[model samples]
Target chain A: MCGIAGRILNAPGRVGNDLVELMDAQEHRGADSTGFAVYGIPRDSGYILRGMGFNKARLDSDLEEFRLLLKEHGSDFLEDPTFVTSDAAHYCARMVISDPKDLAGWVKDADTISDSFEVQSCGRSLEIVKDTGGAVEVADKHGVRDMIGTHGLGHARLATESSVLPNASHPFWARPFSDVAIVHNGQITNYFTWRDRLHRLGYRFLTENDSELIAVWVSHEMSQGLTMEQALKLSIKQIDGVFTYMIARQDGIGFAKDRYAMKPLVVVWQDGEFAAATEEQAVRRIYPGESEVINYDGPSITEIWGVGNRRAAA
Target chain B: MSEIVIDVGQRPIREINEEIQTACKTAKPIVVRNTLSRHNLGIGLPPGVDITFEGSVGYYCAGLNTGATVTVEKNAGWAVAEGMSDGFVTVGGYAGMSCGAAMIGGLIHVKGNSGPRCGVAMKGGNIVVEGKIGYQSGFMSHAGKIIALGGAGESCADALWQGEVWVAGEIDSLGVDVNVVEPTAEEVAEVDAILDPLGLVDTSRNWRKMISGQRLWYFESRDANAWLMI
Candidate 1:
């Protein structure tokens, strides 16, 4: 089991504190790892590179090699990268690349450098920070409470089926697809079948985690001209699992559940703002007063909200 | 009649819950204000205490209650009065999923609609929902009485085992191994007893009682359809 929390503000605002508190509230569901995929203002001509390392020593050297690779690819850093140690086993780094279009190639190259070096997220407006720890510890180490974004999603993973490594953490980026991330609760039964299919279609997978399959599949569908809502609807029929998953993109945030509706997801909306989580307790921490909370009935239920707008489709 | 008031917005939830537990030891009347959808409020309370929550609550409110009377002024999230052995829980507004789930004793009442799986795995006790209920109400029920005044959604009383379900409105469909049976005089009296205390008496609507057909427990070679039903 895992905890998934997400928020969409009608206007662009700092959502870091809210996301942190949300993950904290649902911390009981998963304590193995925690992460966030936050969408902020876009830079004019750069991409934010967030990565995780096995440790501080490895992270420092990995950052150096990453810089050399950027220079080798004719890319320059917008500024000096910042690195922070989350724990003895994990560290996080963030840097801005001068060439935004080269992010995919840069990530592919970076992954080949070392098995321990993993790019968490890279996009114009999206940044992902994840590591093995409690939600509060991860937030404090990464300064998640101070992050500013219009919409975002957070995850706390319990590591039911995989190793408790940084690469196995949630809020997985749809690699090669910019500004898209997903957090999911529940397991996918047909993960191997779908993974093989996507792999046959030229999709490269970095981790063996089943949740990563969702990101790749959704990104693949979107590349084929399907909207996020359409892709999610189609996925409900395709993916065989009792799952509830949330996705955040540059334009909007959305969530859907499997046909069995075995997982729980509660949503609350008031004053053009929306918050959803595995339980209502996390949502209540955001809007603690008179806002009404509604249970999202599953069996192929989907809801979406565009950033800085009240255009919600259910 | 002394009343202890707790403002949850001002005080931490753990502290407030501790105070309630302490108060209930002495059978004190406690009033909690500004609940604001916090979870685990009024859970596992002892007997003979009265508690009132002025606002909404999150998951597992008044769960595992043993003889206390808890009242919510507004809506309640998931699992209200779950696993309760005895007590009375009243929700003024809607309730979320698994309300009165696995309850063994006591009574739970919802004034508005209740989400899915109402009275699921109920061993005993009585549950009454005034408004509509979501799908799979009374799923896997062992024994008890459930009354839905506003009707039930899909698959009402699925896999019911010896429990009594009385619905006043239309049912979307009956679940597996369940059948609508004629309400006997004793059954009608039980429903009347459960509803009379709320000052609600409705004779205009027709009521149906649902129970499980015990044919699925045994395999009979002579009856071919019995194998399919099980």
Candidate 2:
């Protein structure tokens, strides 16, 4: 029970603010959390702006000096993270770039950072920020209300069996690998079997949701130097039961439906542009023009856009 | 007086229904062309209209029919007259399984082989399969006459009541509580009356008639031989 939408434009460069407007219609699909990944690198460095916090007063006073310390070490920090309290209960911050080598180094210094946080530039091609809340709240606070991109993916989670926590919110990004995420619909009945196999391969899992297992499987295959499409095509065979999924890799985005075509995946591709969603209404609401719209049955591969225009491998 | 000619040109059934629903409000017949290999031709016909699907239908062709006459120029799908009431469905080709299943009041004519359970739990109307039928032809027929042109499958007649069954083919086996009985010439004429609309008559002096001994509804065993195995 989630909504996902993404579009690929032929005249790429950057999309302005319309992305948030498109996602706003599907806010009900995910009430617990909201987020988006902009396909650009943040310029400022070392200043990790933690957007939403319960104790703003405490974090304001406590982290002020540490924020200054980062600026003192040839690092420029911007910490005025804004949270759109009216709509979204989230916040966003921009960090300055100082020491280029120490980008990942600051992540290990957990003692200096108060909150349980994470910071890493995935593939140096994408920036990911996700938290618990609705779309308006997240977009208002993160300043994504006016954000746009040529390629991106978003998920609004409807937690069926799992608790509504930050980690459970999608689009789930696989750890230790950047620029790879997955948003899925339908259950993985054979999750345990795959989980056991992944554990044997020294891969760690973050959430109990079966959807997360797919990220690990794909990441493992990618680590072997297999391209994103190659890895996903291979992983589809090992998974059992009905499922329709979309994978956002560093270069491109891929979507797949199960063998039986049990789940739904509607795609509309036209004029060198493509948009897909769980329902036709979602796609129509955004693109709403006459185009060739078709339902994705089982065992079909659609590669909409990628790093260099690679067709989705069947 | 507008004639809507529907030929197979990649138009989905949903699109056709929109036109049919509008035409029914003004009383018109939908003339369908190139119905061969077209699936779900006249499924779930709307009220107050007549639809003549000009060719064979794929699967679940005329299911849940209500207040409409759907005459197929060719064969029909599985469960052709499933749960239909107050309508008439005629198939010129072979029908699959469970024809007129749980039907209330409708008429279904099949010109070819019927798979299995030709009329299961038929409450009203009549189903006449003009060709051979598969096993368990009428497993639990409650009401309705199942006229078979060719032979019947194993267990031809099971536990049935109220309705009548006439099989022209050889019965391989009998189901539980099914009785074979001699039919009077007057009763034979009544069976022939149902086929008059479709113009199918077998007057070769070699017709066999079978009926439930009315024991299913009354629950009495006057005759030791539930089936008159002649």
Candidate 3:
């Protein structure tokens, strides 16, 4: 079992603490790994690189190697990367770099230096911090409670079909698609079939986690000129699974469940903000007000909260 | 019966729940006041106790109740009275989704609007909604009775398996394999017994009853259209 939570605020402010609190409420859902995709203030021409390590020592060495690789590839760092201890067994760092047209290629090349080193996310406004631990502890380690953003997505992963590794953690970033991330609860029955199709289309996958395919598939559809609402509506007919998933992009955050409504998802909208989670307890903790919380069920129930003028499709 | 009034706004949820549990051990009446949308209130209570929330509550209020009588004076969040077995829960105001979901044996009364999947997957229970309910009110239910007095949303009783549904108002649509059946005089009397206490009786309106057709339960090799029915 896994827990997925997301929050979208009408105004730009600090929401990392809200996400951490939300994740802590559903910590029982997952204990193996926890992570979050936070959308902070956007930059014009730089990429935010977030990498994970198995330990502090290895993370320091990997960061050194990553810096050397960036220098070797004629890429200039806009700011020095800062490394921090995420947990007893995990570490992470954030770096801002000048525009590299082949950012995906750069990330793939950086992974070859050490198996313990993995790029969690690379985007203009999104930074993913995740590791193996309790969701609250990991969030505290990454200082997620202090992050300010417009919207974000988080996951508490209980490893069932995969190993307990950072690479297998959720809130998977849709690679090569800036500012796209997804957190899903439920299994994808047709994972390999869809993965193979995307792989044949020259889309690369870093992890074998089935939830990552949702991000890839949705990103593919959005790239094909479909709106986020349209892409999610299409997923209901295509993706075969008993799933409830939430997506966060540069523009908005939205959630969709399978037609069967097999998985549990409760949403609360209050004061122009929306909070969704695998359970209503998590949402109540975030917005402890008198908002009417709705149990999301039925066929193709989609809700989207856009940043500005973008209205919800459902 | 001694009354213990605890203000939920001033105390933690855990403390309030523990106090309620302690009160239930002695079969005392507990009144929880200032419950400003706090989740998980009145959960896992013992039998023969009466607990009342003076204000609105958050999710899972009175969930998993065995035999306690829980009353919320205001609106409730999602999953109100979920998984309840042998108890009575009354919502004085609106109720969120999945009200009385998967109940084994109990009675859940919602005096106002109930959100979607009101009696979903109920094993054995009786739920009465005084106001209109959201879509898919009794989806995938097995062996229970759902009475919606005002009306129900689209696909009112989808995938019903041996359960019974009676709606007095409009049904936007019906789910797959669910069929409306004429209610007998005995069945109408049974419904009257359930709603008479709530001061809501609509004998003039055509009360529709629905049941599962059981078309999706079996497979026939000779039947060509059986696969498409599901």
Candidate 4:
């Protein structure tokens, strides 16, 4: 079992803190590793990059190659990349870089060096902070509680279909799709089948985790001219699995449940604010006071909750 | 008889449950307060005990209950009366998925709607939902009865085995290998007997009683006959 959460504030406020509390209440669901995808205030020129390097010892060399690749793509780092190193072999980096001339081409080239250095997210607003620990531990290590954003997503992974590596954790960013990320609660049964199809179509996968497949699959559909609502509804028929996943862009959050309705999603969307989690107890942490919960417990269900005034590419 | 109040604000569930067990022995009505939708609040209470939770409760609130009269003032999380042999579980508001899962004997009255699989795999007892039962409610029950007054969600009463699902209003869809049959007057009276105590018996209503088509049981029966004689 896994715990997935999403929070959309009425305005750009302490969404990271609320998301941390949401994940903390559901740590028991899966404490294998916790991750947060916080959408900070959107930038106009530079994209915020969250990446992980497999070997902390070779961080300098790995980043040097990364910088060269970025320069080759007509984008250069605005500042030196900041690193968060730990006792583990892997290290996390945060960088601000000018937008690449071709975003998809740069991301495809970036994945060539993904064996050693992998970019987890690149968005004008979204910054994914994840590590191998509980919610409190990860939040403290990455200063997640202080992040400000209009919306965000959180995940507590159990490592059902993949290894328990930090980079394998969620929320998985839809690669080459800026500001789009997903956190899923159920396994995708037909993961390998669709992964092969998407891979054949030039989409790259970072982890063997089935949830990563969903991020790319949904984004792939949307890229093919389907709106977020249309893609979410289509996933119920095309994706063969028992899943309830919440995907977020800069503007809002959208969710879809599989046909079996195996996974549960509880929500409190009131007063222009929205909070959803795999369980009601987790959402209670966000709305401590009395608030009616809407249980998305039906099969083949999809919903889209628009965030503040931000406009997403959709 | 005086009433006893128990607070369950962020305290360890084990300690709170132990206190509840102690309070049950007093045979006085017990009220649980500040229940922040926490899981595993009350489990396996003995006979003659009466308890009421103030607000929403998390998963398995009155699970494994044995003859206690339990009430949740608001919503209840998954498997509210799961694995119960006997009890009275009343959710004043909505009850989450698998509301009476694997229950043997009891009555679970959900005033509000129920989540998916309302009486899944129940061997005996009855579940009365005033509002609509959610998707695939009464799934694969070995026995027992599930009555829904306010319609039912998709795939209602799917793949049953001797169990019965009675609906008063619209059924979105029927499940595979299900046989919808007209209820005899005697069966309706028996169902009314179960509902009379809760003041929910209404005549002049159209009833659709669903049962197993007996197709799913045939293969299982053939497999059972070939069991090793160990």
The most accurate candidate by lDDT is: 4
- By TM-score, the candidates rank as 4, 1, 3, 2
The lDDT-based order of candidates, best leading, equals: 4, 1, 3, 2
Model 3, residue A205: displacement in angstroms? 2.0
What does candidate 3's lDDT look like per residue over A98-186, in tens digits?
A: 86657666765775754666777888889998877887788767789888887898899988766887768988887667788899998
Fnat for candidate 1 (0 to 1): 0.43
**Model 3 pairs whose backbones collide:** B86-B105
Worst 10 residues of 2 chain A by lDDT: A42-51
Q: What is the TM-score of each candidate against the true structure?
A: 0.89, 0.52, 0.86, 0.97
**Model 1, runs deviating above 4 Å:** A55-76, A86-90, A100-114, A309-314, B9-15, B25-28, B170-174, B182-186, B215-230
Per prediction, the TM-score for chain B is 0.91, 0.81, 0.91, 0.94
**Per-residue alpha-carbon lDDT of model 2 for A1-314, expressed as tens digits?**
67666655444434324345445656666677765655443223232232233244444553464455455554544344333233333223344334534533332342244342223224344555566777676666556645434566666667775777655566666555655667777778889999999889877665677888877787778778987667666666778766777887556678766643445555667766666666544565556443454545324344545444322321
lDDT tens readout by residue for model 1, B101-163: 999999999999888788999999999999877777888889898899999887788777888
Could you list the iRMS of every candidate?
A: 1.8, 13.0, 3.3, 0.8
Q: After superposition, how far is residue B71 of candidate 2 from its true place, in Å?
A: 18
Q: What TM-score between 0 and 1 does chain B of candidate 4 receive?
A: 0.94
List the candidate 2 regions with Cα displacement exceeding 4 Å: A12-18, A21-32, A41-115, A119-125, A129-137, A192-206, A300-304, A307-314, B1-46, B49-230
